[model samples]
Target: MRSFCLLAFVVALLLPTQSFAANRDQHIIVVSVDGLAAYLLNDPKAPLPTIRKLAKAGSVAEGGMKVSNPSVTWPNHSSVITGVRPEKHGVLANGVLVRGAIDVPTVVDPKRDQQDLIRVKTIIDAAHEVGLATAEINWPCMRGSKSLDDSFPDVPEQVIHMTPRLRQELVIDGILADETQPSFAANSVVGKDLIWTEAACHLIRQRKPNLLFVHLLNCDATHHLLGAQTPAGYTANAYADSCVAKMVAATKEAGIFDKTTFIILADHGFTSTPKAICPNVLLRQNELLTVTAGKMSDAKIHVFPEGGIGLVYCTNPATAAADREKFRDLMKDKEGVAEVIFPDRFTELGIPHPREYNQSPDAVLVAKDGYAVAGTPIGEEFVVANTESKTALGSHGFISSLDKMNAPLVLSGNGVRTGETLKSVENIDVAPTIAKLLGIEFPSADGKALNAALSK
Candidate 1:
């Protein structure tokens, strides 16, 4: 009897693992259209035929997806893949916020790799662990991720940062001049988007990774240059739609369109702000900050602007309490100051405490509608009119609870509920939903799988 039991155990061990191989045939592609607000879908003037078709053919989040606090590109994108907010994922900005010495100004450095920015395991990591192929194109905070089988990261020198295989392939296909090619610069934003689209399509056709992520940036750039809901924004949306169509075509050409699922969504929405609120000027006037030689030399406090919000950092811990109170008093009756969020409310707002994460701010300043935050410390006036050459006409990075920051969501293709409209969803739920569709285990995710949108 002992010999028979030993033989059975050996047989079981020799067989393939059922759990990891269950959904080997499934493919999931997540595409993020930058600056695609939920309201744009209902706008009569917004040109989005491809996106509209996807909505009609599959499940739609009518109320849109609520993003994490500090609704910027990198943090929300991290939440989309990790199924957690900034408090858990630890990405406070578009990159790593380096807390320098008390005498130096805190800086947001974007040159860091994935391991430096993200604290939690991503969906790509889970998939790769189970022997599934994964790829990311123009995805931020993924500069040097070994989990991805193929990667074309979004950084300063994109062409140089691509994985060795991807760079070689692009060069062989005549898409790029060489491995040392400096930039992907094009005549217009639309032209630059086309290059990224072409690279993504090529990746899909050749690699056919089980999991893929693609980010398009034309709409976001256009919205910043011209206000949202304007004619220029509409044109940019139309260009993004065409890029989506090309990706869909690539899937079809690869013969995986029937077996593939596409999650088309945006990181956050845009808001128009005609005026700029310079909270750093207030700190400068109170002698909390000092500038010398055209640069900040000695600073007791600093305000880092993130579009519609400003992150207040106190350089000295001993004076943090007193400094917060003093700044609150300074901006008591300011024109564009909306609310001063102190450290006590950080937990409720899904932000980490400064003691826990270096990127966490001592306080957060919210801007009122029609106003955006600026980091100019030496401006004579605290609030100034936004000019086309100086400031962005449209911005995001506001509190996620604001209705104007709601992002659009659409799920289509295999394993999706057809023609269903969801009232609302959160961006953190995306990773778990993808895991469920792929028959993978993502037990550490904070958000639950969106079972309502899945057909099983």
Candidate 2:
């Protein structure tokens, strides 16, 4: 009996420990520069000193590719953190789909899911599971993330909350003092650059989370307001890059510089399209879209009325099949329309196409590189006036060259190989690499560990 008891105790001691562990003392900071291109790092013309330095010292993906459809902020951002596609994570677009279960339309309510509601283990969650702390500063869809040690949900104030006059009064009170600087008052967490810098710096100085995620949208906002190649867009890009430099400095000042691994990435690239194609106008010509007072608030347009698998959804499902056929035939008739995809083709490209929900648009249309589609009807051929407007400067949401696929993944510091490059990799691979760095289990992750690039 004594021998058996001793043997049992020895076996128990030899068993593997049941918790994830931080593989290194160095921290991992994931930064997203909205609409940033991979070339930004190597572009000497762009004055991004800190980013260029990191690129030179770290391993970088040739260019970061993104997921398809809605291809907007929330889904792609969620994909990098969660290691899943939009379909799997359920963030279809910047806007949420409303099936009329509630009295009001449901936007992407960040508060719906509690922390543990995330089924897939995020890099942060994996870090935490293995006993490493985490933090996020202004990353999208993070309003309800319970795993974060510190977070500020991107809540905007409405006219109902405070009038312009009242807003000034509140600003004087410093009730809305910027988190970074604590001196200025700004409307959104983003514009208060000094505040975010201060807040992130403070977190790094004090708590020192194992994984930190920061997203700065000022650049993308600038691009949306200015064209991609325009001076305004370039200036915004420079400003965003400077903010990144500040972050790198902060980590170093905190004395975690050597141990921390920093990664700079972008969600998607921007494009310049100056025309809007109104498919609804064509539907009107066919008597499919009935306009009341020349306003269309409730009616849906069969954007790709002729595609085999559809992209858009309308209240009237009965007309979809015939309408899809019509839209496809019309595009076929048009000279410049590049590609028209039905719902079926989206899946073939490895893009998620949900069959159970009406999340996708009607038939999808792809215009040439210089062309853009508008919500309103103009003519068979039309140009968006004021194409030079700030809002007309740059845009995205199309299928084209890798220039739109441009983004970067630069990893540096402890546990990561210095001065390396990941030849060709997918965005899905980020989660697993972080998991390996933190020594956590991400069993369901589709990406590899990228062990070849990092220290074992």
Candidate 3:
């Protein structure tokens, strides 16, 4: 009998852990507050009562979450949802980088569908595959997704781009005057955020989706316009808190608060910059690119700006080697230039190789902390002052390794460990963690489920 008991215990240990078992009835709401730095939670003056309460009740990444390279919105958000970096997910920027002819300038087009942007299976797709209902509001790379039961995509002309049913419901509920472009465009940034919050609450009460994703943009915009740690930035953070409170209230009203889990996080953090570095201006001055009518007509090289990082593309393949060498010489002693990252470093940084991906840049130019990358070939000056009245005072999209790029992450409610503090986490880990909470399989994810943060 003792031997049999021991055998049974060993078998149980070999079996799957209960902490990772599927919970089909469980609901998870992922809220991405753009530009909400991890440090803000520890700030005494920051207004984040609701988020702090959630952290106190559940697990928190005290050291913050490391984001993907470039540290931009679309790439990091895709990492959070797909459990992979930009290289695997195929999202190098906020949109698809369309490569034209050898002499033609490439463009980042944001009108592409979700199917065209994301290469990997998302957590939402996994949940929907197993008969789980899902919804997303203002979530990036979710435009025209069939997996979502309801969606208001974060794209140009959002109201018109939203699912037909969602548009009709919003109109019927008096949240929108009509589905016209002009009507939706009339609302201010804050007003649009309120609409999104209301839509989220309505979905919680009505559809009760098994998984829901919400993204708030006010803090990010505020940071860009007024800079981080400013009074306006605090107000924007407070407003985001209010939005979360409303969603929490909706969950309680729907009688699912006890069974629901809330994962609040951000894509990347923000930093203030005193100067903007225009590498394209330098290229034009060197005659590497030609400007016509204040716009780049043709180029041997072009630099695509991603906030504090610039993607240097050799538009002319024939002169690629020479152009790169020339670019290095010109930028070697340039102020505000931090590092010139080549293809050799792509693998380590989770960036795609130029040979494998057409959108990949030949070289990456990272800016110093107090400078931002700008793509303006027509500008006479290579470096210009960043002012509130002209350019944005703050920006992100630095290399993810920078400490200032760390974002916040808090997991609360059902299936989560209580009063736990994690030293650090990765944005890629979020998807698998959410999948484990729902008891779903996400085998293709590059990141493992954060078991320590889950309750037994």
Candidate 4:
């Protein structure tokens, strides 16, 4: 009787040990560099020691990947986590119409704890179903998210929309939730927030979540404030690199470094521009805009008389081919206009042209690299002149330029092939690959599984 009882105890211990090891294999950590470029690792001029080490330690892609349209922060980051496009994910833009007013919310909504905003299942959600723990820091589309067992959340700062100092403190107010807070870059030296590394370390040591996601937004803020090439932008990137290194070291110290897999990715890259163009000015100048509306926020540019949606706002679908030619000629003639794509061409570019539901805009005008669309209000036939904002040195949102599409994706750690370069892949592929890695499923995702980068 004593021998049988001892045997049973030994079996119970062995069974749980095997199960815990298997769960460790299934866990992963995803980190976002915000605007990390694949070249950053290869660039001798830039010193990203930690990233270089991670690349050396595991598999790394030569170039990054991105989603279809509005290749901005919210859309791309959401895709990274959920593996769904903006069209499918329902996070069409950074801001969505909360009420009748165009009161769109940024990724950092004050009401993120609600959890109903998410339309798709994230990698974490899939993990949680199998009894895995999840955590996130500054990941977008996280409001009303149920995927996390613990999350720092991609919330906006209180006080001002961009001012996150107060909000950061508030997030860490509770015991279980107060593991770590993000280290934000400060305008002044006196008010410096700790780096992301410190916060990530705290989470690892305190909560020790299974799947962790983090975003470092200093690069995006730098790009918005200064052009990519400026001294300030360069400095900001270096600072971000330092923060990344700290997080990597912390993971190592936690003794989970070798057991963990790290995926370092970015939302989009940056480019410098000399000027910004607003095609709405031309439409208003030509009296091409017809106003029977109070205000037009979802603006599109139409080509001519209107065969299909040429641009977003100028919706003259019945326009003749000759007029379409004229609009194309006008867009081409513009100095800053990069390329003018007709509806058919737009569809080929992966964007469904706005039709009855504004699917087909008349003609889509791509701004030259380094230029962006001016956020001008539309009323009757009118052009809101663009005030030169410090020469518009750094900007994105162009299809013709590679900067808009190119982003970095680094896969490392367990179950990832070390030093492998996937020459070609898309942003949509990330979700499916993560699903397979964790033994989850997302049948609705259009992205195919990148099985080559994974290990058996």
Candidate 5:
């Protein structure tokens, strides 16, 4: 009997530890607040009290989430979901990148076209693979992204894209409705945020998807319209918090509150730009550019502005190498030009090279701290002052490393370590952390799981 007992003990010790496995029953809800600043989370006097509660309950990153290079909307949002950089995911900007030859943003292109460009696995894909139901409520790169639907197959029907173009049908105020006759007009900030929140709340109640991703961009729009501290911005923040409170109530009402984990974060921060610089006009002054009918009809190179950064695409491939060198030389010491990022510098920053894809730019022009890159056509001035007499001018899409550009990262519940503050974390780390919490895998993720923020 003693010999048998000894053998059983040895066999048990060799087996895999059950503690390493994730709590499959635990649910994860990610609420993306589009332009939340890191200082807002750190500030004890900021208007956001609910966010502070969640931060204290679990953990908050003291260093905030450093977003992808350029720190634009879609790219960083894509990174948060893919656990990879912009280069790996193939979404370098919010507007669709013309992968054919233009190598620039096509603002009018369909979201599905944008979706098809994503290359790697996302948390949604991993969740679906493990038989977990997932829903995307206004989250970027999920509507018709091949990475999500190709792996999941049932993703399209599960999304509620509240934007004016892809608005879904909903029953608001207990009445059937669509964007055409929205109970809340889809264009307004309230409409965009509230409609999405209502739709997401409905999904959580009815579908009960194990993973629900909700993006609220009201604060972003408000900040752009009235600046961060205006009454409208505060109103937007309050409504966003109320949305969270609603979801929390729903989880408890459904008896899933204790099993649910809530993660609230933002894509990038907002800052004011003193001027909008048009670099293409400078090329025209040098006679290197030609504009016919207010467009770059006969130009050797085209400049696409992205807030505080601009990408210059060489129109002539034969002279591409020479054009890059010439453009870099011409732009040196130019007003508002911070650093002319050449192709060689791209790889070091994890930007995809032009040789690998048609969408890659030859050189990216970074702006000075108080400047933004203007999408000015041929006739516009080289630099225009940012007039604050009209709409408030808060902006982003700058390099994420800037102190003011750091976005918030608040976490709570599930396996999160209570009252802990991590020193550093990037938006790329979010996907893998979600995957780890769900006991899933995203093999192509560039960021490691945030082990420091999790409880053993």
Candidate 6:
């Protein structure tokens, strides 16, 4: 009888993670709902049943989750997964700017690939190393990497974007194969979110991946159109909450309710802007930017616009310092510009101190209240009056110091403290916390695990 028991134990250790995950109490699911703000979530009318329930069961960061430098979606999301700043991870902004490259791709650009970007390993890498099945649902950094067993190609091509053509790509993924599904309709951001929820539930049941990373849109998408915390934004938030509940129900139906750990977080918060500043336009006025034959020339100084902040890259190695100082001088007290970050101020924001990437921006230009920075090189004016997008009147990537910039974080499951409120935790801490819970080693992560969230 003893020999038979020993043989069974040895066999169990050799099986795939799914089998072990069933017996062990270490499954973790990370759900990143874009544009989730503490201010909105706490509002009495906001639909936060899933978030509130999770908070009630585990630890909730009362003040909120602080995003990485610039507080943009891609940068902060990458920071959470890699536990490092933009400098180390190489995601300088949502839109990659290579000074001399022929292509500049947006999130949905067909040519976009994360191979040259994403310098470090993510939580998915660590989990995969431990012989676990890992999955990602529209998280950017891992798009191109082979880290996910189930995935959307990390390329911008697989964004499940709102465009009619982009939406076509989703139908091809078979998630929306049923033309009868609401997602098959035109302009359905909500439908896309629903499909992602379905995918999460599907993957959870089918593969039962040890670590599942999910990203839900509605809130960010809606807030970008309606403005932060507005009725429309609230509706989006509520929709996201329902999706979260759906995923949770999937875990329960899978019969692993007692073993799974769930985390709900956002990349950053959103705020309204009165005007938009085009630093490149200003640079052109100062002759620092050169346009020839109706096209932008490869000027020594280039500004990369990232909604609320602009990164100024100086290509001339010899005069990099001088140009950086000049860019600072040009933006100082400028109508819509606030802080011209370089040198000490740059590192002070917890950005990578000595950015090793050749294309790293020489400085950052922060927008003032009621303003944002646009990267348009051909703008007729340096400062354009604000308009609206289909999403929200508010924007993120603003000053991180403001309380409004705070996003929410809720943790629940085995080993997590129940009904506790944490004072603080940054986006960088997320990956490490997941690694700790999953028993994976990730030494490159800069953020510490939230020990306070774990039960003593």
Which candidate comes out best when scored by lDDT? Answer: 3
TM-score of structure candidate 3: 0.94
- Candidate 4, residues 227-264, lDDT tens digits: the string is 55557766666776677676677777777776677777
lDDT of 3 by residue, 1-456 (tens): 999999999998986554346576798999999999877888887899999999999999877999998799999989999999989999999999988898788899998889999998999888877778899999999998889999998888787789899889999999888989798888888988899999999999999889999999899999999888989989999999999999999999999999999999999998888799888888888888899998899988888888889998898777777787778888997889998888888998898998899889988998999899888876678788875214578889988888888999999999899988877689999999998888888887898888888994
Q: Between candidates 3 and 6, which one is better according to lDDT?
A: 3
Give residue 341's error in model 1 in angstroms: 0.7
lDDT of each: 0.87, 0.60, 0.88, 0.57, 0.72, 0.74
lDDT of 6 by residue, 1-456 (tens): 999999999988896544243323477888989888877767898888888998899998888988787787777888888998876786766645455532221122224455666778888777776677787776765555666677743334454332243235445667766433232444377877887788788777766777888888788878777777678988888899999999999998887777888999998888887678877777777777787775567566777666677777776767878988888887777787788888567666766543556546678788876677776666567677666211125778876887778888988997799978887788888888887787667789988999889873
Off by over 4 Å in 6: 1-24, 101-115, 159-174, 178-187, 291-298, 353-355, 378-381, 388-392
Write the number of the candidate with greater TM-score, choosing between 2 and 4: 2
Q: What is the lDDT of candidate 1?
A: 0.87
lDDT tens digits by residue: candidate 2, 408-434: 677766777766678656666788888
The residue-by-residue lDDT of candidate 5 on 196-246, one tens digit each, is: 777667666766667888888788888776666667767777777888888
Ranking by TM-score: 1, 3, 5, 6, 2, 4
**Local lDDT at 348 for model 5:** 62
Per-model TM-score on C-alpha atoms: 0.95, 0.81, 0.94, 0.73, 0.85, 0.84
lDDT of 2 at 224: 67
**C-alpha positional error of residue 252 in candidate 2 after TM-score superposition, expressed in Å:** 2.1
Error of 6 at 299 (Å): 2.9
Clashes of each: 0, 28, 1, 28, 0, 13
Q: What C-alpha root-mean-square deviation, in Å, does candidate 5 show against the real structure? A: 5.8
Q: Could you tell me which 10 consecutive residues in candidate 2 have the lowest summed lDDT? A: 99-108
Question: Lowest-scoring 10 consecutive residues by lDDT in candidate 4?
Answer: 99-108
